[model samples]
Each structure stands twice: as C-alpha cells, then as structure tokens.
Target: MQVNLRFFASLREALGAQRQLELPEGATVAQARQTLIDLGDPYASVLAADRAVRAALNQQVCEGGAILSHGDELAFFPPVTGG
Candidate 1:
C-alpha cells in the first residue's frame, strides 16, 4: 500500500518535505516510522527518541494501532506546547 506523509515544524525541516511513501502490506503507523527513521540524516533528527513526535492519520490523532492504507494521509509533528 501507499500513504501520503507530511512533516511539520522542525520535523518538516528534518524530513525535507512531505511525500507519498510505499508501505508494506498491512503495515502499522509504527512500522512505517521505522522506514522513515532510515530515510537520512533529516529523518534521524526528526525521529530522534527525545522528540516524542506526534502523528495524525487522515487528520485524526492516532495511536499505535492506527492502520495504514493506500493514499492515506499521515502527518508527523512534535507535541504541541502552547498554552
């Protein structure tokens, strides 16, 4: 399957830009992240453990169980902190 991916804030700088990615059959959000982690230096910084980045599936904040599908839009961003 394939999914549309987006990066926001600092994550966007690290990821360079959002684009479509091919995912393994039935891959979960977490699984897809591992692939992203290998993308490059940008990905390494974006996916660093200290960041605790957030993900949304089709505009909905999703958890570990979030399933992936063709053409699904997924976004990654750092946790919101403003009051």
Candidate 2:
C-alpha cells in the first residue's frame, strides 16, 4: 500500500515536508515510523523511539497503534505547547 507522509515543525526540518511511502498491508502508524527510523541518519535521530512525537492519520490525531490504509495521509510532529 502507498501512503502520503507529512512532517511538521522540527520534524519537517529534520526530515522533510512530505514524501510517499510504500508499506505492507495492515501497517500501523508505529510500523511506518519504524520503517523511517530504519533509514538511519536524520530519520533515525528525529524519530527515535525515545523521542516524544505525535502522529495524525488523515488530519486527525491518532495513536501509534492506529491502523493505516492505502492512500491515507500520515503526519508526524512534535507535541504543541502554549499558554
């Protein structure tokens, strides 16, 4: 399956604004993240398992375990903080 990936904030700086990825059937958000991490370098550093990152599926906030579908839009960004 193919999905659209979007990176925001610092993640965008580290990775990029967008890219297309091919994942196996029934891939989850976590699996997608792992796939990028496996790329090493900036991808691994920015998306390290220990880092606090947030994900959205099709513009809605979702958990890492959330299942992904073909052509879905997946976004990754750091948590927002404001007062």
Candidate 3:
C-alpha cells in the first residue's frame, strides 16, 4: 500500500516537508516510522525510538498502533508547546 507522509517542525527540516511512502499492507504508524529509521543516517537519528515524536492520521491525532491504509496521510512532528 502507498501512503502520504508529512513532516512538521524540526522533523520537516530533517526529513523534508512531505513524501509518498510505500508500506506493506496492514502496516501501522509505528512500523512506517521504523521503516524510515531502517534507511539509516538522519532518519535513524531523527525518528529514533528514544526520541519524542507525535503523529496524526488523516489530519487527526493518532497512536503509533494506528493502522494505515492505502492513500492515508500520516504526519510526524515534534511535540508542541506554547506559552
């Protein structure tokens, strides 16, 4: 299955604004992240399991366990804080 990926904030600076990704059927958000990390370098560092990252599915906040479907949009960004 193919899904759209959006990166925001620092993640955007690191991985670009957005890109299309191909994932196995039934892949979860966490798995998609892991796939990116598996590519090594910046991805492995930026999206590392030790780091804090937030995700959204189809513009709605979602958990790592969220199942992804074809044409779904997934976004990753650093936690936000406002004064």
Candidate 4:
C-alpha cells in the first residue's frame, strides 16, 4: 500500500517536507517509523525512539499504534507548545 507522509518543524529539516511511502498492508504508524529509521542516519535520529515525535493520521492525532491505510495521509512533527 502507498501512503502520503509529511514532516514538520525539526523533522522537516532532517527529512523533507513531504514524500510518498510504500508500506506493507496493515502497517502501523510505528511500523512506518521503523521503516524510515531502518534507512539509517537522519531518519533514525530525527524519528528515533528516544525522541518525542508526534503523529497524525488524516489530520487526527494518533499514537504509534494507529493503523495506516492505503492513500492515508500521515504526518510527523515535534510536540507543539505555545506561550
């Protein structure tokens, strides 16, 4: 299955603004992340398990366990804070 991926804030700086990814059917957000991490370097560092990365599925905030679907829009960004 193919999905649209987006990166924001620092993640975008490390990775890019957007890209399309091919994932196995039934892949979850965590799995997608692991796939990117597996590519090594900046991906592994920016989306590292130790970092506080947040994700959304089709504009809805989701956790790592969120299931992904074909053509789904996935976004990753650092935690947001406002004064």
Candidate 5:
C-alpha cells in the first residue's frame, strides 16, 4: 500500500523532505517512523524518545497501533504550542 508521509515544522527539517512511502498492508504509524529511523542519523536523532512527537493518521489522531491502508495520509509534527 502507498501512503503519503508528511513531516512538519522541526520534523520537516529533521527528515530532510516530505516523502511518499510504499508500505506493506496494515502498516502502522509507528512502523513508518521506525522506517525513518532506519534511514539514518538525523531521523533517529529527531524521533528519539522525547514523548512530544505527534502523529495523525488519515487526519485523525491515532495510536501507533492504528491500522493503515492504501492512499492514507500520515502526518508527523511536534506538539502544538501557543500562548
């Protein structure tokens, strides 16, 4: 299945660019992230355990275990902060 993966704000810089990913059936958001980590250093560094990373699957917030299908749009971003 093909999914559109977008990284925003700090994540964009960290990931280098937004990319289209072809993943296996039922891939989860966490699985996609792990693939990014395996890509190399910057991704691993950015996604390292910090607890603030956020992900939205199909425009809805979802746990890492959420199942995904073809044509899904998964987005990753830093926590929203406003004052």
Candidate 6:
C-alpha cells in the first residue's frame, strides 16, 4: 500500500515537506516510522525511537498503533510548545 507522508517543523527541515511511501498492507503508523528509520541516515536519526515526535493520521492526532490505509496521510512533527 502507498501512503502520503508529511514532515513538519524540524522534521520538515530534515526530511522535506512531504513524500510518498510504500508500506505493506495492514501497516501501522509505528511500522511506517520504522520503515523510514530503516532507510538510515537522517531518517534514522530524526525519527529515532528516543525522540519525542508527534503524529497525525488523516489530519487527526493518532497513536503509533493507528492502522494506515492506502493513500492515507500520515504526518510527523516535533512536539510543539507555546508561550
């Protein structure tokens, strides 16, 4: 299955605004993230397991366990803080 990926904030700086990713059927958000991590370099570093990243599915905040559908939009961004 293919899904849309969006990167935001510092993540955007590292991975670009968005791209298409091909994942196995029934893949979860966490699996997608791991797939990216497996690509090595910046992805492995920026989306590392220890990092505090946030995710959204189809524009709604979702957990790593969220199942992804073909053409679904998955976004990743660093945690936000406002004063």
Q: Each candidate's TM vs. the true structure?
A: 0.88, 0.98, 0.96, 0.96, 0.85, 0.97
Task: Give the poorly placed runs of model 3, Cα more than 4 Å off.
Answer: none
User: Candidate 5, which segments miss by more than 4 Å at Cα?
Assistant: none
Q: For every candidate structure, what is the RMSD over all alpha carbons to the true structure, in angstroms?
A: 1.4, 0.5, 0.7, 0.7, 1.6, 0.6
**Top model number, TM-score:** 2
What's the candidate order when arranged by decreasing TM-score? 2, 6, 3, 4, 1, 5
Per-residue lDDT tens digits for candidate 2, residues 42-74, read 999999999999999999999999999999999
lDDT per residue (tens digit) for residues 1-83 in model 5: 99988888988887755788888998888898887777778878887666478999988988788888899998988989899
User: Candidate 3, overall lDDT?
Assistant: 0.96
Residue 38 in model 6: lDDT: 100
| Residue 8 in candidate 5, Cα distance off native in Å | 1.0
Once model 6 is optimally superposed onto the true structure by TM-score, how far is the C-alpha of residue 11 displaced, in angstroms?
A: 0.3
lDDT of 3 by residue, 16-54 (tens): 999999999999999999999999978999999999999
lDDT of 5: 0.84
Cα-based lDDT for every prediction: 0.84, 0.97, 0.96, 0.95, 0.84, 0.97
Q: What does candidate 1's lDDT look like per residue over 1-83, in tens digits? A: 99999988888876656988898888888877878777767777668656698889999999857889888999988889977
Model 1 alpha-carbon drift over 4 Å, by segment: none
Q: How accurate is candidate 1 locally (lDDT)?
A: 0.84
lDDT of 1 at 77: 84
RMSD of 1: 1.4
TM-score of 6: 0.97
- Compared with the true structure, what per-residue lDDT tens digits does model 6 show for residues 15-81? 9999999999999999999999999989999999999999999999999999999999999999999
Please report how far candidate 6 places residue 50 from its true position, in Å.
0.2
What digit string (tens of lDDT, one per residue) describes model 4 on residues 1-83?
99999999989988989999999999999999999999899898889899999999999999989999999999999999999
Off by over 4 Å in 6: none
